[model samples]
Target chain A: MRPSATAYIYIAPAFALLLFVLFSPVIYGFWFTLFRIEYGAPTDFIGLGNYVRLIEDPTLLPTLSRSGVFTAACVVFTIIIAMALAVWINRLPARTAFIVQMVVIVPWIISAVVATLLFRWVFVNDIGVASYIIQLMGFDAVQPLNNPTGAMVLLVAVSVWKRIGYAVLVLLAGLKSIPDDYDEAARIDGANNWQIFRMITLPLLKTPLLLIAIVLTLSTFNTVETPLVMTGGGPGDATRILAMDVYERAFTNYDLGSATALAIIMFAGNILLVMSYVRLARWQA
Target chain B: MSTITLSSAARARATGRHFVPRLSWLWSGLFGCLVILNIAPLIWGILTSFKGQADLFRFPPAFVSFTPTLENYERVFLSGFGGNLGISLVNALAAVVLALVLGLPAAYAFDRFNFPLRRLLFLAVVASIPLSIGAAALLIPNYVYFASLGLTNTPIVLPMLYAAHQLPMAIWVIKGTIEGIPRELDEAATADGCTTFQILRYVILPLVRPALGAAAILVFVGSWNEFVASSVMVDSPSLRTVQPAIYSFIGFFGREWGPLTASATLAILPILIIFALFGRLMVSGLTKGSVKG
Candidate 1:
C-alpha cells in the first residue's frame, strides 16, 4: 500500500533529521575506524591494522569474558527471580498483588545514576548496612566495590534489582493472559501446582519469556553506569566489561582507532544476537 | 467415579497440609524482605542528604540526623550548580517536545495509511537504538562533525541528540496507540467531509491522549536521566546536565556525600512526583504498547 504524496511530505522532516543525527555519526564512525587519527591531526589510512591490534590487545579477551559473565549472570538471575515473584504475586488476592507490584515497579523509575549512587553508599565497607550485618554474623568484612568477585556480584545484584521490575511486570502480563480455566482443569485432574505451572503456564509463556530473555540480554550486555560508578572496573580489572573498556580506550586513553574498531565488533556481535533472536521468534511463531 | 475416588484420595493424602501454608508464609516473608532491601538504599540516601557533612560520614551511619540543615540544598542552588539543573530541565523538556513534534505526525501517518516502505521505515527507526549510546566510539566523529557545523558544546546539541535517540521509541509507542483506535472513526470523519489533518485533529488525537501523555512522561524521564551523550557532547560547566554536575562530588579526595546526596534528591524529585501521579497510566501504556507493537 502506498501513501499519498502529502503524507510522504509530512514525514520527510523526521526522515531527514534522523538521517543526519542518527545515521550520519554511525556511518562516520565506521569510516573513522579504518584510519589512524588523533585528537588534532590528519587521518592516515591504516587499513586493517587497527582491527588487528584490537584482536591482539591483551585486555580484550578478559574484558569480553567479564562482559559475558556479567550479562549471563544478570539475565539468569533477573528472569528466575522476576518470574518467581510474578507467579507468587499472581497467586495472591488482587489488592495484595497490586500493592506488591507497585513496590517492585518503583525502583525502575529512579534514574540509573541515582540508583548507582544509592547502591554505592549501600555497599560502602564500614558504613553500609550489608557490611555491618555481615560483620555481625561473624564473617570477615567485605568491601564489595574493592574485590573483583564481590564487585561483579554487586553489579549483577544492582542490575537485577533495578531491572527485575520490568521483567516481573512483563511476566505478570503474560501470566494474566493465561486463562484460569486451564489451571482449574489441571487441578481437577490431580496435577500438583508445580506440575500445572511447568506444563501449562511456562509453555504458554513462550513468547513473553523469549522477549524478556532477549531484551534483558541486550540491555545487560550494553550496561555501563553500574560498573562505572560502583567499581570503576577496579581490583585488577576484574569487573571491567567491554563497554567500560571501550569508554576507557576512547576517552581515557584516547585510542580512537582501536576504540572504534572494538565498538564495531561489539555492534556486530549485538546484530548477530538480535538476528538469532528473530529467527527463534520466527520458529516459535 | 474413578476421578472422584482419586480426588478424595488426594485430599486425604493432602491432610498434612501444614507445609503448604508454611511455604506460603515463607514466600510472603521473602517478598516482604526484598521490598525492604530494595527501598533501604534510597531511604539511606534521603537520610544522608538531610544530614550535615560531619554526620554524613559518622561511623555506625546515623539513622536519624540530629540537626538537619538546608545548607546543601542552598549550595546546590546558589553555588553555580543550579545552572546545570536549568540546563537539564531545558534540554529534557525541549527534546521531548521536539520528539513529539516529529514523531506524532509520522506515527499518525503510519497508523492511518499503508505507505510504501512503511515496514522499512519502521525498521530503520527501531535500528537507531543501538546507535544511541556508547558515545565514546562516536565522540571523535561527532566532535569533528559538530566542529565543522559550529554546534559543539552548545545547548542546542543536547536536545538534538536526545530527540534523535528518543524518536524511534516515541514513534513506535504513538503509532501503537493510534492504531488501536478503530478505523471506523476515521472513515466517519472522512465521510463528514473532514480532510486528513482535520480527521487526525478531531478524531485521532483525542482518542490517543493517554498514550501521548505516557510517551511525553517517558521521554521526559529518559532525557532527564541521560548521561553519556550529554557528558561527551557538552563540556561547558554551565551547560552540563545534572548527572555530570553530581559527579563533581567525587573529587580526588574521597567524596562530598552531603552535597551529592542532596543534589541527587533534588534531581529525582520531579520524576518521582510525575510517577506518583501518573504511574498506572504510564505502566499500562508502556506494557500494552510494547506487547502490541
Candidate 2:
C-alpha cells in the first residue's frame, strides 16, 4: 500500500516542537561555549577559548575524578543489588513478586529531594535514629553530615538506594523473556542451581545488564538533585562532583563560559551513552 | 513457557522444586531488610510529621506511643503549601495531556503507514528517552536560553518543557501498543466506511486504553516528581511545585522537623495513592515501554 502524506503531517508538529523546546538549547549550548557569557549576556565569540581555559583550571580535574568515583560506586552497587534482588524476586510466586516490586519501588517513585530529606532525617546531628543507635552502642554519637568521608559515603548510599528498584524492573523483564526450558533443561541435565544461573541466566542477561549499566551511568552522572539536597556540595566541597560543579559554577559563580565548556564535555558523554543505548536496544530487538 | 514435554504433574513438581530453594532463608532475610530499608523512611517521615517537637527529640524514639498532633499539618497548610500542591497538579496534568495529544496520533501514523524518514523519525523518538535522563546537562544552557528570551519565571514554559521531555517515551510506548491492533481491525473499520481520524478515535483508541493509561502514568510520574527542571525553570515563589516547595521548606524551617515532614508527606501521599491504585499496570507499562520499545 502506498504510504500517505498525512503521516508526515501527523509526525512533523510533535518533532518540530520537540526540536525547539527540548533540543534547540543543546545547540545553543554549543554556541555559548564559544562566547564569554555573563548572566545570559554573551561577549564576542572566542573559538575554543572556553575549552582551553578549563585545562589550567584546578577545580575541573578533581571534580571530574570525584564524579567518576561517585558514579562508579553507584553503578557497581546498584547493579549488584538489583541483579541479586531481581533473581530472588523471580523465584517467588507471581502475586508476591508484584507486591515486593511495589514496596521496592516507593523510594524511586518519591522525588529525589524528598528521598534525600528522608535519609538526612535518619542521620540528623543531635536527634537522629542513627545517632541514637551509636550512643546506645557506647560510642559517642557521630554526625555523618559534617564529616567529609561520611558525606561522600552517604551521597553514594542514598543514590544507590533510590535507583535499585528501576534496575530490578528492567532486569526482571529480561529474566522473564528467557524461555523456562533453558533453565529447566539444565536442571534435568544434572546441573545445579548455581551452575544453571551462572551459565544460562547470566549469559542471557547480558543485554539488560548493559542497558541498566548505561542507564544508571547516565542518571548518576547527570544527577545534581541528590547531592543538592543531601549535602549541598558542602563540608569544604568534599562531595562536589562534576554535575554539582557545573550547576554551582553556572548558577553560583555565574561563569557561563566555563560552565558551558564543562557542560559541553558532560553533554558529549551523554551523547555517547545515548548512542550506545540506541544501538544496544536495536540489537536486543 | 518452557518447551519441555513433562506431564502436568511432573511440571507441577518441577515448579515446586524451583531453583534456589535452598537459599530461601537467605533470600527472605535480604528481602526483608530491603523492604524495611525502602519503606522505613516513608513511615518515619509520617511519624515525625505528627510528633510534637519534644517527642521528636525523645530518646529511643516513639513509634506509636507519641501523641500525634495536627499542628504540623496546620503549619504546612497555613504557610501556603496548598498553592504549591495545586501548581504541581497543574503542571503534571498539563504535561500528561500535552504528551498524549501529540503522542497518540503520531504513534497511530507510524503503525499504519510508511512515510519518508520513518526509521529515522522512530529512532529520534527512542533517543529522546535517554535525552530526558541526561537533561541536567542541558539545564544551564536551557536556563540561559530561556532567560535570554525573557521566558523564565513563566508558567507555560515548565509544563511545555515537561511535556516535550516526556514526548518521546510517550510516543515509544503508544507506538509499541498501537502496533498490536492487527491491521485487520483497521481494515474492517475501513470496510464500514470509517474515515482515518474517525477510525483512530472510535476503533483504535479504545483498543489501546492500557497504552494510554501507561503513557499517562509515565508522564505524570516524570513531571510530578521532577525537582531539578521545576526548580531551574521558575524562580517565582508563586509558581513553585510540590517537590521544590518541600525543598524550599528547608530554608524556611531549618532544623525544624515538623513542617518539613508534613510537607514531605503531603508531597508523597498523592503519588503513593496513585501508585497503590494502578501499580501493577504501571509496572507492566514500564517493561512494555522499555523492553518492547
lDDT of 2 by residue, A1-285 (tens): 227887887787789878977788988888888887765688888899999998789977888888999999999999999888899899888998888988888888888889889888876546877777788889887777799898999999999999988998999999998999998899889897789989999999898899889989999999988998899997888899988888888778878888878888898899999999888775211
Q: Against the true two-chain complex, what DockQ does each candidate achieve? A: 0.46, 0.60
> In candidate 1, which residue ranges exceed 4 Å CA deviation?
A1-3, A40-42, A276-285, B1-12, B16-18, B129-148
- Among all candidates shown, the one with the greatest lDDT: 2
Q: What's model 2's lDDT at A202?
A: 96
Q: State the C-alpha RMSD over the true interface residues for candidate 1, after superposing those residues.
A: 3.4
In candidate 1, which residue pairs clash? none
Steric collisions counted per model: 0, 0
Per-residue lDDT of candidate 1, residues A51-124 (tens digit): 89999988899889999999999999999999889999899899988878877876777777778888787766
**What shift in Å separates residue B274 of candidate 2 from its native position after superposition?**
0.4
lDDT of 2 at B284: 82
Weakest lDDT window of 10 consecutive positions for candidate 1 chain B: B129-138
